[model samples]
Target chain A: MVAHATPKSNESKPIAALLVAAAVAIVGILIVVPLVSVFYEAFSRGVGGWWAALADDPDTRHAIWLSLTVAPVAVAINTVFGVAAAWLVARFRFPGRSLLISLFDVPFSVSPVVAGLALVLIFGRQGLLGPTLAWLDWKVIFSWPGLVLATTFVTLPLVVRELIPVMEAIGPEEEMAAVSLGASGWQVFTRVTLPNIRWALLHGIVLANARAMGEFGAVYVVSGHIAGATDTMPLRVEKLFQEYRQPASMAVASVLAGLALVTLVAKFVIERRLEAESRDLEAARGLENTRLEATRP
Target chain B: MSIHVRSISKSFGSFQALDDVSLDVAAGTLLALLGPSGSGKTTLLRIIAGLEFPDAGSIEEDGEDITERHARQREVGFVFQHYALFRHMSVFENVAFGLRVRKVPSAEVTTRVEELLRLVRLEGLGGRKPSQLSGGQRQRVALARALAIRPKILLLDEPFGALDAKVRVELRQWLRRLHDEIGMTSVFVTHDQEEAFELADEVVVMNHGKIEQQGTPDEVFDRPSTPFVMDFLGNVNVYHGRVENGRAFWHGIPIDYPAYPHAQSREARVYLRPHELEISPPGAVANRLGTSLAASIVRVTRSGPITRVACRPHGSEQELHVDVPTETARGLQITLEPGTHVAITPRNARVFIPGPEYSI
Candidate 1:
């Protein structure tokens, strides 16, 4: 029998080879080289210099502390909001449902600086709710809360966008089945719906965390960049660079860069696990066929 | 338990899904809701299971009104068309889900799950995930999970619609046997006529959100009340004809119509099942009572034990289809030639006057 060339095998064509090489070259020049240079510049004076630059600088320490405190709180809030929003949007119908879903993606489409400025326009001392805020003695812009608010706005769509498709694809059948089998509303969610979407939810959280930690443009606009107070990690790196502290700047930048690499690896690992799960499911189906064939007389 | 649904009316947007429909199911009897798509059979089943509430109706179970009860409080088992098994859990856990949610002890859950698995013939296969099983196995697992709760009534929506043909037949027979073994009051919705006929003692024929007829399978097969029920039941040949003097006549062939004996010649339709027709050589049978039509053979197909013959009548453009046993075809010397003359006689045919407009 003559063998037909499958699409996977066709990837060995010369055109595919050329395209792959071109992609690798572009990635090396654009992404890999800059990344390597950042780490190289950070460690130029040695590991001891890197450590001292991070520890000896009080403003850098405060910025790091501030970032740790702010992003997680935003993530936690968005986690709750993500599940609720995804469930509402995926499982039910109401007025303006499509409009509300598209509205959730506003942060993604609007510029980060624009979102930050919009927040400032709303809650800043002279903006829409400025009187209410000032009367209540509440500080929003140029404070830790402003940082949290800006970070949350930037990462709002990540968790929700990830979960909506998964939940919608699952549909209401399993929940219906669960309820008909005598499960309460909460039991249907935790026992049936949550398990079905847990991987996607976790995947969303990971992406949200990465975006939360790395958000800069919006934070730069809202934080006011006060040293040892409102300045976050990205803002601190920029401050160090402007003060001619190149190696120290690169040191702090490398930490952020390292966190990004860690997130990349984590994302890659999670995606691989997800693929493995679906592949195992398909493989099980294929195994059933082969087992049936083997048992046939 | 007996279930009574009264005056159920439901609408989705402008589509009237169920319009003032009422029905009753006897206790310990298997009933099949038979219909095509948009017939509201599945909707009625969901209302009974409390997954959906009727727009204006009340549902009663065992003489108690439960229309306002939530699905979680209904204690009814529903198996979805797609088997809706919890994909992340093992088969054992999927079956044990209902018991566990009710806080049944772990030991009892294990024993009950094992028993249900064995009943479904999946005793050793309980360790696998739902995705790890074949379509038939997955459906059986779903049945086990639904049966795990031991609810008052069981509802299934096209349970075997996903399986291959051979497996579907096997599952159908097995499901009937299981129904007999358990004898729980069950109602299943199906569009497959054979499945409905073979599985249910009582069959309810539905069309356009209304119950056309409800009776035993034999009663419905023998006496379908409406044209929709007759057409939906199986493949039938329809002829444009007329009824006069208590007889239905098509091409000078008088069909038996004892029910319509009025001396009125009006436009009517005659429905004849393919298997109910007998095809033979012309002038062979004594043509008494005008029960025969003269036709030429168009084509004959032999498949297994059945032979399907297509014949077109002389001096007419219409064609008649007849199904005969292969042995009987040989006995009658039925041929596949397109121009050979033959006679086709319907053993029994239905006659109905067409309304102003008949929507299939």
Candidate 2:
């Protein structure tokens, strides 16, 4: 007789084992090996040798500094815009509201390199708005502003898209209760809405930050590969690899790779919270739709 | 605080949720907006609580117009149908939220929340999160949080609609007692007529975005001003018949019609509740020829206090429902079983002229 089947009844022992082993083998070859080798090759010439490769090149240090500053600025701008946009679209109904939400997703569909090009068209020396910037004596394209703008454009959809469903699922009943209990609008958001959406907001921020830091296609277009000035970490990695400095390239690439690993871990924890939030949403929706909207015959 | 809603009308796009609905809640009275779904009871309660603005009406508290004021400025306490407790905060923090926002001192906030927690009878469970509590417990926490502000009016939107039946009954009694003690001008929405009758000092019956009637429970029940009110209050058995010459006839069985003294003969309907008719042994109504109808018992069920008997009269396609006391059914000393013949006699039936088309 077969043993009692679990809820996972589709499972078969040999097939499961084979599939798992095949998956592990594929991951080991395609992903695990490459990820491990990045660090292994980084310290191949020893830690001090890797340090000299990084310290010896002021351009690499400056590139590291550029990524550090650009990602935060991009993430900060996205965080505020995302929450505001999500709050606006989620809580209110206006003309063109859904169209606006779709427009926010344009960044995802459009290539990051294409977005960088669009930024160049609008802010570059020979681009539209170039005359206004020139009159104001401000440099945008081939400068820090262009890099920040490109990075911000590439990560725009993360926060708003993440927040809209969660906020809509949570509903406005709690905020209404707070307001009815004598809480101001500002207090309702700060003490109630923000805390409820904190995990989801953090989840979106981590994703945006990861994309902002590791973005190469967009940052490379605007940075101009200027040594010690505009070249970011990803652009610098491309430069070193082009010059045949493989060890130093791996060393700088390792830093971004390590950050990606941290973002993944942070995402793992936040995802657990978000999963619980969705379950709560199911229960809350049941209460709302079944009872609150229940009317007579 | 007494709330007065004056000629309120609201529409959700094409659906008219509330239409010129007006009602008044006396000070310290517990009023219930009772209706079926889409009856606009919840909409009226929300409007009174200042959570919703009417398209063409004003809300007044003791004769002062507060229509344009926001919910926070109105100082009303609202309990949502689903106990919308802050999932992230502890029960203590939720109760202290309104107090903290009002800039109450930290010590007073603690004292007030503790006192209110005791009032709601959740004294020591304040440290637990709302998710950890039972549905009834969460409901009480929502109440405690709402009451922390000492609001002028207390508005509950189907407070027990989401709870299980037993908890609903328990909370109903508890809420009644709470209202008596607080003496606040409180209003609640419910579709259960029994709930409205039992809990409210005055009941406002609504249907299709309009008020059908509003009165004390007995006044509304005993003397329904409209046929809609009568039909909505309880189950009524209908018999298609004709009314003429100060009498209504069902298959030539004459019934008294004192209220309608029309000389003209016209078709009508006789509405009788299950208890309004009497059941007799097979041959007991031989002398009562014109007053009784011959029928066979289809089924008899003793559900709770009443025994329900399903009967099918001869030459009638419609089945009739008859309710008797369980004790009375046992005392009849006759074949109350299925297929057993009996004589059904009407004690008195209310007569109403049929509409353009026949209706049940």
Candidate 3:
């Protein structure tokens, strides 16, 4: 006897087509149009205009360098913290686990400006840790350090949020199995847990990197918008727009947009690869089950 | 090596998973912890493997206390119910994991892993990932991986629970032979009574986080020490009544019952296996076994070699199942059909004074 009664699939083709059309139209307006428009406007003043905005404009050059420098640092710091946090939250049970997980979501929930404000409240000149930091001759409020700090705060949850679900789904059974097989704690994590989570970790890192590179409000509040020192790619785009350098603004915007596109593509590829790997694993298990059933007496 | 588990008690929040459970495994003996889900058999196995810690009690391996040791330090090989083989690793790498983790020589790891792959009868398939192997094959790989460490004790938690029935039986036989050859002190947890009885030299039956009985297969089957054991092992008819003057009265009829030290309790429960009860004509007196009750056949079912007759005692709502050889039913002159009255005599029955533990 069949266990489940099959659901009818007599959906109207016209309605399905209408739904697909609606979705495509929405994506076209929101994503495709803006993406095409950025490149269109960037090259409106010709290739020299684009190159002049990027290379000739020293502030924009500094902004590019600043973004490049800060994003990697933020991504690197968050990557280590993300894996550790995911491991702690997913593999072990403890009091306040939900609270810790919720705290990770704070960056996602709260406004980016509020996150920057919170950081400033703690690290600004007259802020809580400011006096002691100043005693150590540390100027954090309008420096590269503040920009990195704000970027790190804003992008902190990206990798961690990506990792938690994957780690939790992977479960503790494999780790326990490793431990039972005489693997030490470190060995178990390195050999078993790390391999299982590596793909998800990479995906998380990509997302975190993308966010760190594009972060604006948090970095803006902490950066003080120092022309050649603290201005990031997004801040530079805003500055160029205010100066009526439309092509330069669009040019910097286009670069950020291009990076965003690359991030999206990388994210898509990683997710697809993960999906394919899981599907292959599942199909292999199904085949194995069939073979075992065939060989059964 | 022999292992001793002493008064292990573990509680998870408000629920007690194990309550003062103790067991011993003789050297090179195969033991089964048999219980239904939530009965702490798996918990006990985990505790013994050092994968879980008991809130109270001590565990010793070959007379050495190892309760405080980490699972890695305990040197116990554990096979999970789902065959927790490393999915990313090939069967060879999976088997070599333990040795590699211990930093065993590369040549020895390869030789030992090959030997184990052959032992588990998956020699040529070692290069395949765990996902590429059948459930039975994966289970064997898990076993081989556990054995690679040459552990003193091997623990398996429902090792064949995930496989189909046919494969389960095949793996059970293979595991029996494997255990005999390896001669490791193995303790396996399973809820399947048949698997426990067939695979282990000793079986510990657990219920509600406590051991109900522990004995040889025949001993536990033929003489269950508790009502839970009797019911858990096989189909049994239970008769609840009042006991007085060394006899238990069911439906106002006096029945023979084995006296218990706690017979002072007015309430009693009698357990008789289906095969232990014999069916004859209403007034027929066969061999003098025990009390006979006049019952009307409620239903008769013939399946394969056995004919089961379900009958209700006169004026009693409880139904008793009696199984007889189909040939015996054929030889009888009377037709065993519904509505035909028969005398059901209990060849043996266990009488327990009613208590909370005796309730199903």
Candidate 4:
């Protein structure tokens, strides 16, 4: 004979299990499907062709080099402007503060295609100051300079948006303490303010760099996708796909995907490090509380 | 060095934070700005530290004008109530921060940093980050960091306000000893009367953005200048009264005023500290039974050696609590229960000219 069991009140086990399964299935379909397909296509191209695509191909080499070079430069430029803009928005009360913040919405609002087109119109031959640029024997559009500019514009908000909350959270007390300790403005910025925001700044850099490497539309229009000249990995993949070099395209695509994967892992590691540091800090504070309590008379 | 501030007043938009406050700090002495919240104690401290600008005032450090100087240029050391330790830096690094900012030699920084860490009793913890230290330890690191530069003045804004009761008392004692050892001209802001009394060489009592009075702790505590100061620094029983010649009268009741100033017959207020109120039987001979009012004991609280008896007058709506030696409460012979009859006689009450608001 089997005994009947009673279920507890307020415990909807069936619905909870169903919800968890549904959430997991949704994530698997949305992310895992395409990721697995991309990997299968890139690596399944016969060992000889895979090696050529990975190492021996000239176009692959150039695209990989261009990507490595341009992304870091774009991220570097954004870091400076981002820190400055974040500091202004966080620390100072000034006219147009709201307007300046709303400007960050510009990158997110406009489509990347529109951003590329806008860059073209401004720096193109018939655009404003186009004739002056031509007279100076310098070209702005359809060049590496144009690529960097467009990439920087699209990625500028990443660092600033990340840093604003961080800087605001730190407030002015730490810096003020440093100042009262005879630290100059620069010293305070470098020593006190910067260290507190370092994690946020690093997270922002990773995000900006990821976006820069994957950028296609703006860099495509601006660089003209010149073979072995301004062509980056993403542009090279597009070119290879157009040319029906399936194996080559997949190889370079895989490289780009691989870079993204590596950085994604890096981001996770840093996030974990930050979490551990915060937990350690909490534990230390707890210990302090206990010690204080113990020593109380 | 000595510092002088005269007539400092400041307004942020429409809120007046500091108003015409003046204070003078002698060389090599610690001063405490004591007040309740929003009484401008912190504002006055910040103004002297150059962290704030006064709308109207002048500041002089060692007879030299410094009102316009920036906080960094003022060459002062400040310890915040929260410690404000740089979390990323090690204890040694934090102590060396001010020196490093000044581009001191690396060797000199090492020596000074070590010396400061030892001074704060954190000799072995210099390698640990602030995130790794106890709150009390972090506060010491912050103090050491501030002192690393050896500024002409030291400033602390409620330095131990964040600590627990026991730690606060201990740190106050430690701070006093440190001050004596260093001979640094210092100013600290606090709202705790006990802390101010224990720590400051001189106490400045402030009220409503103005310096109500300033003197040694004993002088300020024993003889407060205004009704606000008397009410703020300790528990007091105030009475609405009038002064005529050298005598003070509450309603139609008169009391002998030996030290009462000769003033016109106008409405005045009298303040009597709780401990000054004596409990006596009816028709008992006492100092001066200004008014005999029957009161019933409402509550009794025993605090170690003292017993506080809270009573409400039988015919009036006012309630007063008087603290007496615990032994005295037992000797009363009668039950001091609720509705018990007792008389309250004012032993020493100071009179003041009444104000429009908060008169008595």
Any idea what lDDT model 2 has?
A: 0.87
Question: What lDDT does the true structure give each of the candidates?
Answer: 0.87, 0.87, 0.87, 0.82
- lDDT by residue (tens digit), candidate 2, A125-238: 889998999999998888998889999999999999999999998889888888888888899899899998999999999999999999988878777778889899899899
Give, for candidate 3 chain B, the lowest lDDT window spanning 10 residues. Answer: B283-292
In candidate 4, which residue ranges exceed 4 Å CA deviation? Answer: A1-29, A54-61, A280-297, B241-248, B255-267, B285-292, B330-335, B356-360
lDDT of 4: 0.82
Classified by CAPRI criteria, candidate 1 counts as acceptable
The list of candidate 1 runs beyond 4 A from truth reads A1-22, A278-297, B256-264, B284-289, B333-340
> What pairs collide in candidate 1?
none
Please, what is the TM-score per model?
A: 0.92, 0.91, 0.92, 0.89
Model 3: per-residue lDDT, tens digit, B124-158?
99899887777778889999999999988889998
lDDT at position B210, candidate 3: 96
Specify the poorest-scoring 10-residue window by lDDT in model 1 chain B.
B284-293
Candidate 3 stretches greater than 4 Å from native: A1-29, A44-49, A278-297, B249-265, B283-290
Candidate 1 local lDDT, B175-250, one digit each (tens): 8898888888999998888889998999999988999999999999999988988898777889888887788887
Least well predicted 10-residue stretch by lDDT in candidate 4 chain B = B281-290
Taking the tens digit of each residue's C-alpha lDDT, what string does model 4 give over A1-297?
122344542366677678889999998999777777767777786767777786887767887888888888999999999999999999998889999999986987778878888888888888886888889988878787888888898898999998897778667888888888888888888888887888888888998999999999888878888787889889999998999988788878877787789889989987886676567556655665665455344
The docking quality of candidate 1, as DockQ, is 0.43
* Candidate 4 residue-wise lDDT, B24-108, digit = tens: 9999989999998888888888899999988999999999999999898998889986677787888898889888888999999
Cα deviation in Å at residue B355, candidate 3? 2.4
